[model samples]
Target: MTPEDRFPGPELPDSGPRHQPDLDVLPYGSYYEPEPEPGFEPEAGYGYTTTSGYGGARFLEAHWPTASQQAHPGEPVHPQAPAAEDPPTIELGPPLDKFGKPIEELNFPYPQPEPGEAPGPLYVVGDVHGYLDELLAALHQQGLIDAEGHWAAGRSRVWFLGDFTDRGPDGIGVIDLVMQLAAEAAAAGGYCRALMGNHELLFLGAAKYGDEPVQSTAGTASFLAAWRLNGGQQQDLERLQTHHISWLSRLPALALEDGHLLLHSDTTAYLEYGESITEVNDAVHHLLTEEGADEWWDCFRRFTKRFAFRGDAGPQAVHELLGAYGGQRVVHGHSPIPYLTGSTHLDDGTPPHVPGPYIYADELAIAMDGGVTMEGRLLVARLPLN
Candidate 1:
C-alpha cells in the first residue's frame, strides 16, 4: 500500500555517470525508543556540496555501478500506479543508486542565496537510519523539541547528517536527542554540531574495547559485520558505550554554516581529501585528528559511500561536492532520497518509499535521507529558506 502510495514521482532531466565509488569496503542495521515524537518541517534542512571547475571534475563514482538498477539515470519512472508490493529493504548489496528516474525536471541556473544575518531557527539532519519515531516526528514537527525530551523548548538550530548507526531502532535514542540538543543549542544561543557518519565509522570500527581498527580498502569488511548486517541495534550498541568514541571521533567531514555545506556520505571522496572547502573540511578534520582507527578506516571507508546522485554521475557528482565544498547549495546524508529517487529498493529487511521532499541540482543539491528504517520520514529543516 506504500511505495509512496505506489510511485507518485516524475520530473526527469539530470541523468547519470560522473560516478565515484571506491573508499572500498563491504557493508550492511535496528532499534529502541525513549521519547520525542511529532513530525518535522518548519523551515529547511540538509548538506555537502563542492562542484565548479574542471567541468565538474570530469567523472568518477564507481564500484560496479554501485551494485545495480544499472546505475540509475533519468527516464523510466513512469509508474504512477503499479509497483507496490515490496517496500521494506536492507539489501546493502546492490543499490547505491542506479534505480533511476527523477532528476526533478532539469532547469539549472542557481546562485542567489547569500542574505543571512543569522535569524534562522537553523536545522539540519539526515541519516537517523534508526528512525526513533521518525526522529521524534522530525523533532516534534520542528518546534525543535517539545512533547517531552527537553531542549531550547523550541529554539531550534540542529544539525545532523550522519549514519548514527546502522539501519534503525533508536540509534541510541538518536544519539540521545543529538547529545541533548548539542547542550540545548549552546545553552540557547542556538546551534547543534554533528558530522562523521558512515555509521560513525561503523561504530568506531567495531569496538571490542577498541583503541582503534576498522580497516578497509575493501575486503573482509568489519564494522562489526558491517554493524550486524545493516540493522545493528544491540541496545544501540550499549548506548554507544557511554559516548566518547572520541566525541564521535571528532566529527567533521564538512560544514560551513549559514551559506550551507555539510556531509555524511555523498562521495567524490571529498576530492581525494583537499583543495578547498577549507582544505576539504580542514583535511577531513585533520585525518580524524591524525589517523589510527585502522588508519582512519579508509576515510571512514569513503565517507560511507553513496551514488553520486544516481547515474551519468548525477550532475557531475553534484558538481564535485559543490566545487570542492563552497556550498551555495549541497545538503547530504549518505544516499537516501529514497536511495536517490528510485522510490523504493532494498528487498527483505525493508524501508525505502520516498517521493516527497526534494530539490536537486537546480536547487543545487538537497536530499536529507528520510527513509527512517523503512516507515520513511525523519527530517528537519531551517536554513536560508524563503
Candidate 2:
C-alpha cells in the first residue's frame, strides 16, 4: 500500500462546536521556529521530516482531527461535509528491493559459543518507525537476519530500541517481524528483545482510549488525536490485535547490557519513574497496566521529551541518568544524530548522511536513531563501539 493509503489525510468536519485544546499549554515542548542550517529549508506543512521535535501549535495547526473526525459521546457527526484537500505527499526516500529468497550464502557464519561463553556479541537496533523494508535490509546487512528475515546470528543477543509503528507504510508489519524474530532467536539459542518507546505508549493509548477525553495541561485532549498528529498509520491501527497490545504493554522501558544503558528516549524524565533499573522498569510496567487515561497521557508526554543529552550541560544530564541507572555509557534512540549534531542538511541539501551511531556527550551517550522517516538509514550496530 502507498504511504498515503497507510496514513490517510484527516477528514474535514462540518461547522460544529469543537473542544479545541489551547496550544499555548500543550503540556509538551513549546512551539518555536527551528534555526535554518545549511541546505535546510522549513517545509510549509510540517516543519521537519523526522517526528523528533515537532509539538505544540505546529502539530495542532497542521494536523489535528476535527470534531466529526473524533466523535465524542453525544457529539454530532456530519457525514455530508465536503472532503478536505489531500495533504502533500510525504517523501519516504527510495523504495527498497524485496528479499525474494532466504540467503543460502552465509558470508558470516553464526558463531557457536560454548554454553558458559559470555553471551554472544550484543547488538542494538535504533528506532524503526515503520519502514519495514529498510529495517530488513539493515538487519540482513548486519548478518542479524537471513534473506528470509529470520534471526541468523546464532546465540547473538539483539535489542530493538522500540518505535515499531507509525509514519511509514507498514508499522504492523514491522512489529510482526520483530515479534517473529524474537521467537526464532530464542529457539536458536539467542534472544531478541525490545524496549518501549514513546510511540508504543501513544499507539497503545490510542487503541485503549480512542476518543475518550483526557485532562491535559492545554485543556482536554484524546489519544487518537495525538497519535494522528504524530504520524499514526491507519493500517497499523486497523491491524492492532489484542496480542500486539499485550506484547507492547509488557516491554520494559529501560535495559542495560554490556555496560550500555539502552533506552528509547534521550530524556532524563525517566528519573521520575524510579531510581534503580529494576524500579524504573517495574514502575513503567505498573503505570501502563494500572493507570488511568490521564496518567497514561502524562507518562507518554514525559517520554516524548528529548535533547536532554545535548548542549553544554548534556554530559551532566547523562551522568544523572547513569548515576541512577548504573551504566558505563548511555545508548539511546529518540533524538536523531543529525539533529543532535546540528547538521541535518548537507551543502547540497540532500538528506543528512548518517554513517553510523553517533557517540557524544563526552562519549557518555550514543545516538542510534538514523532518522529513517526522513530518508535516513535504519541503524543496526554491534555494541561497545571502538
Candidate 3:
C-alpha cells in the first residue's frame, strides 16, 4: 500500500463544536533537562574510517568512502556564510506575557524576571525539510536572528519540531545552522534545540549503508530506496559526515514543556517504544546504536504512522498519550497541515496562504508541518496557545 494508504486518515466523524485552548496561561512542567550536546570524534575532514565495530562489523566506518573520494561541491562547508565580524551583544529581557508574543514596546518576549522564573518565551518551529534559504528568512522574520545571521533572540527558548533535512537543498546546511544557533543561544542564556524526526533516521541509515537489504511489512526494502522514495536528496547524503550522524543519533524523539507534548509524528506508535518521554527517547537512541538494518527500518516505519488524533477516537487517544507523557496537548510536525485541509500551494515554493499551526483533534493536537517541499509555508510560532 502507499504510505498515505498505510496510515489511514483521521476517522473522527464531522460533528460537535471543536474545542481550542485559550493558551493565555501555559501549564509548566519541571521535568525536562537541558539539551545534550553530542558529536562524533572527528578523525580527518568530516569522513574517516574507524577501527571500532558494532553489530559485529565496522558499523559506520564500512559504509563511508575516504574523504577525498566523497567530496561534493554542493556541500555547505562549516563557518557558515554571513559570518559577522563582531558578535552582537545579548541582553536578557523580561518574560513574555500570556499571549506568547514578545512585548513589542520593549522589543523582547518578556521583561527581565527573577531567578527560577519561566524562560522569556517559548517558540515552536514546523518541519524545515531542508529549505535553508526559506528557513533563514523565516527565522529573520521572527526576530530570532539579526540581519547578519546571528542569534539575536536573547533569553527565549526555540524548539525545532524536526525534519531538518531531505527533499530541498542544503539539508546538512540547515543542521549546521541549528547546531550553531543552539550553542550561540545557550551562551546567551537562551536555547535552541530540535526533536528527532523520521527523516533524520532515514538520512542516517541511507548514508551509513546505501542498499543494505531489510525485511519490511511490504517484504524486502532498503534505507536508500525508502529515503529516495520519501523525497531524500542526493547532495545531503554526499555531504553527510561523521559528526552529522552522531548528532542526529543523539536527538530526543519526544519532549514536554509548558503543557504541550512535543514529538516528530502524531502517531500512537510511540507507546510501543516507551511509556514515558525519556524512555521513548532512550529507546530510540539505543536502537540507533545497537540495532541492525531490519530493526532500524522497522523503527523508521513506525515513525511514519500518523493521524492518531483525528477521528472520534482521537481525543481519547490523545488523552492516553498525555497520561503517559505528562502533557495536556500534543504539538507535532510530520503530516503537513495542507494534507488535512486538502489545500495545495503555488509553483514557487510558497503557500498561497496558511491559517498558521492547524490546531485540531478537538484542539488537543497542533500540527506544524507546512510542507515546504510541496510548496507549502514553513510555520514558526510561540507556544502557550494564546
Report the poorest 10 consecutive residues by lDDT, candidate 3.
18-27
Per-candidate TM-scores read 0.29, 0.72, 0.69
How do the residues 302-386 of candidate 3 rate in per-residue lDDT, one tens digit apiece? 7877666654556778898999987788889987665544454434534433446666666677788866666556777666422
lDDT of 3 at 367: 80
Clashing pairs in 2: none
RMSD values for the candidates in order, in angstroms, are: 22.1, 17.6, 20.6
**By the lDDT metric, which is better: model 2 or model 3?**
2
- Which 10 successive residues of model 1 have the least lDDT summed? 88-97
Each candidate: what lDDT? 0.52, 0.67, 0.64
lDDT of 1 by residue, 248-343 (tens): 666666775555667776667778887665566566666666655665666656665665554334566777776765556677776655434434
Model 1: runs farther than 4 Å from truth? 1-80, 91-137, 142-162, 165-171, 175-197, 204-206, 212-238, 241-264, 268-299, 304-358, 362-365, 369-378, 381-386
- On the 0 to 100 scale, the lDDT of residue 107 in model 1 is 27
Candidate whose TM-score is highest: 2
Q: Give the TM-score of candidate 3.
A: 0.69
